[model samples]
Target: MAWALGANSNSPPFAPAIGANAISTMRAAFLIGIFAAAGALTQGGAISETVGADLIGGVTITPLAASTGLLVAASFMIFGVYSGYPVPAAFATTGALVGVGLSLGGDPAFGTYQRIGTFWLLVPPMSGGLAYVTATLLRREEVPETVGVPLLAAVVGAILANIRLGVIPHPERAQGSLAEAASFAVGRPLVAGVDVVAILATVVVAAVGFRYIRAKTQVSAEQGIRTFLLILGSVVAFSSGGSQVGLATGPLENLYSVELGLPSIILLGIGALGILAGAWMGAPRLLQATSREYAQLGARRSIAALVPGFIIAQVAIALGIPISFNNIIISGVIGGGLAAGSAGVSRRKIGVTLAFWVITLVMSIAIGFGLYRLLSTVLGIQ
Candidate 1:
């Protein structure tokens, strides 16, 4: 989680110098390259596969179109990162793809649009509600660190265990339980991952419960709650990376893989680098704008804003839906603030942002359609 936050927070300060040279600039560039590369290795393959194979109606993107989309999206991100408010990379890129596809006279892929819309709509409320419930629960007298943190950790651990070890019907990959993984390393009878998972969960719960019972100090309780929030933040960030990277590159997948004969992996590598650049150059200003211009968000409030953004972003990535991180973050901030109190949320800001969203989508679509027609006409070919 810390790593994820660091990635998000540190990026805006380093990206510009990717084109420069200095000990610090070179180091920043190198780290950016490394993370982008690592992200490609970690997330690129699955994302590229889905984008290339899943996002169309038997369509093969033209090389001209793919390169055009990639260049267009990349240019937009750089512009946002350096000058304009950081528009969501997901929105810009996805919009470009849709634009290009429509330009080619392809019917709107409603199924894909529907899925993306649903996730975008669902993420903010769900994450905010969860964060609220978690926050409220920690405020109660009956929770303490040993009990709360460990219990939450155990739950997280169990999910990780199950997701990793459980056998899927299709993939045939061995999904070992966390407990099983731990036991296997020491040559123990493989604990049924589920049973071991349950036991671990119980122990964590008991520890937290006892600590709450023994609460002799207020500071201890506060420490425990912060730890829990930190853990939640971490979980949200890592999951987000997996889901959000696709927005940075999914549109060009068919162009790179099918049209240009580049490996999907290479396409992904390019996309990840683009995202890393977007984050480093663009995100901070947007973050500042949201943190201050949209609403005053202290750490507690910011957590409310960020948790939902992360959840929505991840869902977008998981399903191969392109969306703006800023859009998600801002929307989540609005919802979260509304949940806290309607007074603090600014109506004008919301109106302007929403209006921008509509304009961005419409303009991108129009431009794409117009450009396609112009190209086809000039070439005297379809």
Candidate 2:
């Protein structure tokens, strides 16, 4: 499941960078693998817990149950990955878990489903709207490249300051952000009900990002734009890993935590290795197929597409939501493409893709439930 999940999913978020020639395919794959592993190790904990425990109520997932559900989900995802169409891996995994939980007599987790479903519904318009605004800003005559590019960089930096990571000490599942850690290290001084140190840290990071992008632009506008795209893609890839590894590792969370008496980090590490291997072995081909053939975006449009994916991925990670990065990136691509006139975008393909997401979710649920029940009956385990 981890291997197929890695191969099928994480690569597309960075397709823009490779498609734009901002980075070599081999190098980008290498960096993506590394960053993805880093992200999984550092931030996969909360998401893993959410999936393994919170998604279904009253059922402690047995190893057999986990294996059954994952087998069903992974088989479907592998078919979609090879068919060269974007499949919603998150939907499959989430639905599979729900189905298997039901087979085990667990009650429906409507609250969790509601939260995830709402987020999934919002991805299209929110990502498209943001991408359109960013692309428009990049194309504006009044906003110089130096100012506009740096402004976006500053915004990313500000967001980066508040992203939670596993390395930060926390009371429970809630990890601390960089800004919070900095404030704690110095002395939590409140300025008008705000952490003074966190505010200062945010400002400093944002200013530094702004200045750095501006300086890069000063050196060479074209190179600077490419450089920013590469950076943005890398961030999106990292965020993708954090948001995605959970789908593969979530089932194993209960297996490790209960029976094996192992840490969740160990499961994350296992999934991370699978992601790294997938990125190294299979990412380049998928990257080429999606980027070169599907959408040939230039540097400006690529950046616009990536920025929203990065932000949305981070938001998903922070909220412990399992997200399909392809869904986010495709919406951004459509928005960015439309900004330059919709000549390159295909309405039919988009419609088909949306329909596939819903179908995958419903079908996975049915498959998981039936498969688990059948296996339990034949094996006399349940």
Strongest candidate by lDDT: 2
Clashes of each: 10, 0
Query: What TM-score would every model get versus the actual structure?
Result: 0.68, 0.96
Q: Tens-digit lDDT track for model 2 on 1-28?
A: 7777667788877788887888887887
Instruction: Score residue 205 of candidate 1 by CA lDDT.
Output: 53
Error of 1 at 200 (Å): 6.4
Global fold similarity of model 1 (TM-score): 0.68
TM-score between model 2 and native: 0.96
Q: Which candidate is the best by TM-score?
A: 2
Worst 10 residues of 1 by lDDT: 14-23
**Model 1 lDDT per residue over 1-382, tens place:** 1122223422322221211111143344335434444444354344444444444454555655555555555555555444435445555555666777767656667787777667656655675565455434434568754454445444444443333311222123323434454544555443553455445544555455345433422456444444434443444434444445555456556556566788655655564565555444434444344555555433344444444454454444444555555565566556545655667677887787666666656666566557666777787654
- Runs off by more than 4 Å, candidate 2: 171-174
Clashing pairs in 2: none
lDDT of each: 0.49, 0.85
